[model samples]
Target: MVSSVNNPAIAMAEKPPSLEKEPMADVEVGIAVTDEKDDRPGEGFGEVSDLKRGLKQRHIQMIALAGTIGTGLFLSSGKAIARGGPVGTVIAYTVVGLLVSTIVFAIAELSALVPLSGGIIRPAEYFFDPALGFAQGWNTTYATAMLLPSEMVACAVIIRYWTEQVNNAVWITILGFLLLVSNMFFVGVYGELEFICAILKILLVVGSVIMGIVVDLGGGPKGHRLGFQYWKNPGPFVQYLGISGSWGQFLGFWRVMGSAVYSFSNVENISVAAAETENPRRNIPKAAKRVFVRVLLFYITSMFVVSLVVASNDPGLSKSAGDASASPFVLAASSSGIHVVPSIINAVVLTSAWSAGNSAMLGGSRVLYGLAREGHAPKIFTRTSRFGIPYVAVLSIGLFMVLGYMTLEDSASTVFDWFQDLVSAATYVHWIIIAIVYLRFYYGCKKQNISRDELPWKSPFQPYATWVALVSFTILLLTGGYTVFLHGEWDAETFVSNYFNIPLIFALYFGYKVFRKTKMVSLEEMPIRRFIEIYQDNPEPPEEPKKGWRKLNILW
Candidate 1:
C-alpha cells in the first residue's frame, strides 16, 4: 500500500503522477494505486489536496472521553435494564465492552498501519474489496450523522427538565440550530469549545461518582445509612421485574441490556477521533488502550455506585429513563438524602449532552470531507469554510437534529419514544458494520500474508476476538426489531426502526455507484497507499497543557 496524498495541492511544480485507468467493456471497476490516468472530470484520479494538522493531543483525549459516554448511556441504561434484567444487562454490557475493545484494537492496529484522513475506511480498500470499504465507510458516516440529532434531542430533553413553559420540541430545534452555528465556524474553535465541554463532562462524571460512593458507604444522603440494602434485598439480580425481590420474574430485562449497548457504542468513536489527532502514531494507540479502561472505570464503576444507593425502580428517578435529566446519576442524587447535588447533576447532564452532540457533528462532517477527498462523492463536500470547517457537510448532518426537535410539538412522550426507537435501531446497523469491516480486514490481511509485527498495535487474539464482537453486535441489531414483532401497538415503535436502514443505505451506496460508475475493485487493484499517505499529516506527538485553569477563581 502507498500514500494517497503523495501529491499535495501545494508545491507540486513537477508533473502529476499517473492515476489508474478504466475499461469500457468490463462492468466491474476497482480503485487501486496504479498509473494509467482515467482522468475523469468529477472523479479525479489525482492526489488529494493535503490538509493541515491543527489538532493537538488534548483535543483527542477529551474527544475520546466525551465521545464514549453519550446521552444513550445516561438516559437509555434504564431502558437496557428494563429489557435485560440486572444479570442479563450486566453480562451484555461486559460482553459488549470486551467486543468493542477488540474491534477498536483491530482499528488501532489498522490506524497505526495506515493513518489517513479516511482512517479505518482506508484499510478496507487495501486489505479487503474497495466496494466493501466504501460501503462500510459510507454507512458509518450515516451512523455518525444520526448522532448529532440524537445528542441535540438529548440537549432539549435536559433543558425541559428545568422549565415547564417552552415546548421541549422547540427547545430541541433551537439547540440544534445553535450547535450547527457553532460547528460551521472553524475547526479550531469547535475543538476549543469541545475541550471545555469535555472537561465539564469529566468533572460531572467524577464528582457524581465520588459523591454516590460516599453516600452509599454510610455517609448518608440524609445522615441515614442506606447501607446497601438494595444490593442485599433486591439481591443483585432483581430475581423478578415486579416479583418484589426475585430476579427471575422479569418482563423486559433484555430490553434494558439493549440500552446498555448504546452507552458503550460511543466508545468506538475514539478511534475515529484519533484520525484527526496531531500525532496519531503516538496518541491513537494510547487513547484506544486507555479508552477501554476509562470506560470501564467511568461507566461500570459509576453505575455500580448508583445501584448501591438507588433501587432500579426508584420513583424519584425520572419516569423517562431515556431523558438526560432523568439520568441515574441525577435521580440517585435527588434521593441523596443530601443537599444540592441533584441540581448540580442535572446541570452536568445538560453540558454532557451538549458535548456529546458536538462530537457527533464534528465526526460526521470530517467523514464526509474524507469521502469527497477519495473522489467517491461530490466536490462540494471538500470545500471548507474560512474556519477550516466543512461547513456544507456540517449543515447537512446538523439538519438531522431537527428530527429530534420536531417531536417536541407534542405533549405526549410518544414522539420521543418513536425517535429513540429509530435512532437505536439505526445505531445498531452502524455498530454491526464497524465490526464486520474490521473482521473482514483481519481476514483480508491474512489473504495477503501481512504480519502482525507490521501493524502498529496488534489485536491480542486474532480471529476469535473479532468474531466475538461481530456476533454479539449482530444479536443486538436483530433484537432491536423486537418492537416490530409485538402484536399490538405496532405503530408506537413505528416502521422506521425496523425497516429504514436497508433502503437508506442502499440508496446512498448504489445510487452513487451508478452515478459515478463505481464498481468493485480487486484487493490488489485497490488504491491502498497513494491516497492513504496524506493521513499522516502529523507524524509526531503533541505537547502537554501549559495552563492550569482550576487554580484560578475568575479564570474564564
Candidate 2:
C-alpha cells in the first residue's frame, strides 16, 4: 500500500506528486523515490526496501509444516513421556496445542490485515507501543539466535548416535558451514531446502505412526500385542519429583507443557518471512490456517502414537545417548527387534535439526533487518547484497552458531536442557506480548468505530480467545519451573533457565521505554483508520486457482 513508511516508527514526511498517478508496475514495492524524509526518533536511515519476494506458495506451505516439527518432537519426546507419563504427556500437548493454535489464529487475523514483515513485533509497535516492539524484536532475535546453536548442537549430537569416533566439534564445524552457506544464497534456495526437509519430516512421522500401529497390533517381528499395555504397566501417569498421586501426575503433565511449547515453537514463524513471500496477504493466511492442522497431525498424533508404542519406564529411553536415539520411535523399534529403524530415524532427525537451524537463521536475521529499518538497531543490519540477502544480519547471527560447540564439553543432553529452558520461557514471553498487542489492535478498531468484518481475514471468538490464551500463557510461564521448589529439588540452572526471560523482557521493554521517552499511545492515536486504508489500497493480486491435487494443500 505504501513505500518505506510501512513501518510507522519511521513515517513519511512528504509524498511525490507522481506517486498518486503512477501505476503499480511503474513503482518499486518499498523503495521510496522521494527526497523528503521523516525525522522521528528512529527515522534517520534512508529509504529502505524489503527483502526480495522469492519464497512461493509451496515454500510457505512446507515451511509452515517444517516449523511445527523439530528436535523437540524427535529427541526430547522421550524425556517428556518419561517425566509426564504417556497419558499425561498426551494431555499436556493437547492443551498446549489448543492454546498455541489460538495464538496462531489471532496472529493470522493481524498479519493478514497489515501483512508487515516483522510479524508480532511490527504489530506491537504500530498499534500498541513502540517500546513493546523494541523488546519483542530483540527477544525474538535473541531467542532465535539461541535456538540456532541449539539446533546445530542437536544435529551434532544426533551424529554421535551413529558413532563416537568422530569428535563432536568436527560434526559441528561441517554442519555449521552448511548452515551458513545455505543462508548466504538467495531466499528461495532456503525455501526449497526447507521444503525438502519438511517432506522428509512428514514422511518420518507418517512412517513411524504406521510402524507404531503395526508393532502395537503384534504385526512386527516380535508378535507383541501392546494394546495400551504400557498404559497399564506405567499406570498412565508419572509421579515427578517424588510427589505421589494426583499432584505428581499434574506436575508431570505440567512439565510437558514447556517441552510441548518448545515443539511448537516456530509454528508462528510463517509471518516472520512475510516480507520475503509473494502475495503475503493471501499466502500468509493460507499458511497460518494450515499451521493448526500440521500441529495436530505431526505433533498431537505423533505423541499419542509414541506414547502407545513405548513404555515410559523403558530403560533404553535414558538420556545417556543425548540424541534422537532416545526418541520414543527409536526405542520402540529397537525394543521390537527392528534394528534398522533407529538409523533411519537418526538420519531424519539430523535433517530436522538442521532444517530448524536454517529456519531460525532466516527468521532471526529478518527480525534484525526489520529492527534496523525501524531504527531500533544499528543501520548496518539493514545492508543487503545484490540478491537481497541481509548479509550483515546473517553474519551477526551466524557468529552465534559457534555456541553449538559447547556440547563437546557438557553432555549434549545437558546443553539441550539449558537451551530448552531459556527458549521455552522466551517463547512464553513472546506469546504473551503477542496477546497484548492483538488485544490493543482489536480494541483500537472498536474504539475507532471500525468493523472487524471489513478486515482481510477475521478469526472467530474475537477478544475472548485472545483473553483466554493470554491468561493461560501467563500462568504457564509463571509456573514453568514449579518443580524446582520441591523439598530436595532446588536447581539454580533450572530456576534461571525457566524464569530469567521474564525479568529480561521487562528490562528490555522499560529500558527502551525510558531511554526513548516513549509513552503508550491511546486508541485514538493508533492510526487504525490509516492502516485500513493502506490495506485497502494495496489489495493482494488474485491468487491463481489451485489445480487438482494442489487443492489438498489445505490438509497439511
Candidate 3:
C-alpha cells in the first residue's frame, strides 16, 4: 500500500527498506508534507491547518529554557532548603534532575519521529489507548491552565517586595494582559519574549552563583568567608516530623523531591510547540537535549550555591514572606551585606513568573486545541485565526487567569502554597503518564522491527530507563503527602492539596474510558511504522549556519 515514489525519501506508509547499521549521518529530509488523506486518522489537522510554523530553532531552545526556570527555582527553593537542609536539598534535586533528563530524552526520541502539535498527548493515543490520550490531554491542559494563575499570583507576590500599596488584582490584571498579548499576537512573539526572559533568568542564576562564591570567599562587602560553614553548623540534614536518626534524614531528602519535581514541571514543554516550529524532526530533538543540560546546570548549581550561602536553619529560609527577599539568593546576598541584591532578584523573579505564565498559555491552549482536533473536546476549540493563533482556545484559558486575583482575598503566600501542592502532584501524574507512553512506544518499535538507529534521536538503555522513572514517579505521587499521614501532623488542606490529584487523574482516565468505550492498542496495531514513514517523507532544511564565535554556543 506504499506510494511508488522513486525518490524513496518521499515514500509514505512503507517500512524502512532496512535498518541502517549505523545512524544516517545526515538524511536529506524534504520540506514536503504528506498528502492530507494519508495523514493519521482521528487526528483532524490537515495540510492547510493555519497553525503557523513561526518558531525557529532559537525560539524553541528559549521556550524550553524559559519553561524550566521559574518561581520554583527563585522562590520555592528556600522552603525546600529549610525542609531538607543543604546537603539533603542538593541530593534531592540532583536525583530528580537525572530522572527529568531521562524523561526528556525519551520524549525527545519520540518527538523527533512524531513531531505533532500536541506532543505526548497524541503519542498516548497512538501507542496505548485513545481514552488515556483524552485524559492526558485534558489533564495536561488543566494543569497548565492552573499554572497560569499560579505564576501570575507569584508575580503579584514578588511585586509586594517593592510596594504593597498597589492592589494585588492590579498587578495580576497587568501581568495577565501581558501574557495574553504575548501569546495572541504570534507564536514568534511568544518565542522572542521567552527568549529574552530566559536570558534574564540565565543571568540571574549565573550572577547569583558567582555572588554566592564571592560571599563565601569573603570577597564581598560583608567580609564573611562562609565556605561550608552552613553545612557544618546546620549539619546538612533536618529531621522531619521529629523522626530521629537516618530515617529522619532520609525523609528530609525524600521530602524535597516534590519541590525538585515542581521546578522541572514544564521541561517537557519543549515538544508542545512542535507543530509551530520549522523542521521539528531536527529542532525538537536538539531543543530537548539542550533543555535537559541547561535546566540541570541552572538547577543543580543554584541549589549547591544556595546550600553554601544560606544556612538551612536561617529563619529567612523558612519565611513565607510574599516577596523576593525570602528567596534564598536574596537572603544569601543580604547576609553578606549586599542591600541592592534583593530588588535585583525581585525583578528577575517577576520576569520568571511572567515567562512561566506565558508558557502556561502556550502549552495549555495548544493542548486544548489538540483535544478538540482529536474530538475529545468541543470542536469549536479547534478554531484558529488567519495568523494561526487558536483564538478560542487562548481566550478560553485566559478566563482562568483571573484566578490570580484569588490572592486579593487571601494571603499571597497561602494562595501560592495551595497552588504549589496542586501543581506538584499533577506534575507527578504527568510524568508517570509520559513514562508509560514512552514504554509503549518502545515496545511497539521492538515489535515492528524498527531499529533504534533509525530514530531521529536514540536514547540508550531505553525500556529500562523508562521503567525506573515510571516506578519512581509513581512512588513519589503516592507519597507526596506523607506528612499529612504522620500522627498528630495532619491538616485537611495539606492532605487534600497533595493527594487529590491522584484520584482526579484516575477519574479522568476511567471516566474517558467508559465514555468512549476505548480499548488499549495492540502492539501490532500501533502506527509506529506510519510515523517513521511520515518522518522520512519530510526532509528538514539544512541547519542554519552559525557565524563567528556564535559557533561556540553550546547552551543552544
Prediction 2 global C-alpha lDDT: 0.78
**What TM-score do all the candidates reach, one by one?**
0.79, 0.92, 0.91
Model 3 local distance difference test score: 0.78
Q: Following a full C-alpha superposition, what root-mean-square deviation does model 2 have from the true structure? A: 5.0
The stretch of ten residues in a row with the least summed lDDT in candidate 3 is: 23-32
At residue 47, give the lDDT of candidate 3: 27
Superposed by TM-score, candidate 3 places the C-alpha of residue 80 at a distance from the truth, in angstroms, of 1.1
Local distance difference test, each candidate:
0.58, 0.78, 0.78
The TM-score, computed over Cα atoms with residue i paired to residue i, of candidate 1 is 0.79
Off by over 4 Å in 2: 1-19, 22-50, 548-556
Question: TM-score of model 3 relative to the true fold?
Answer: 0.91
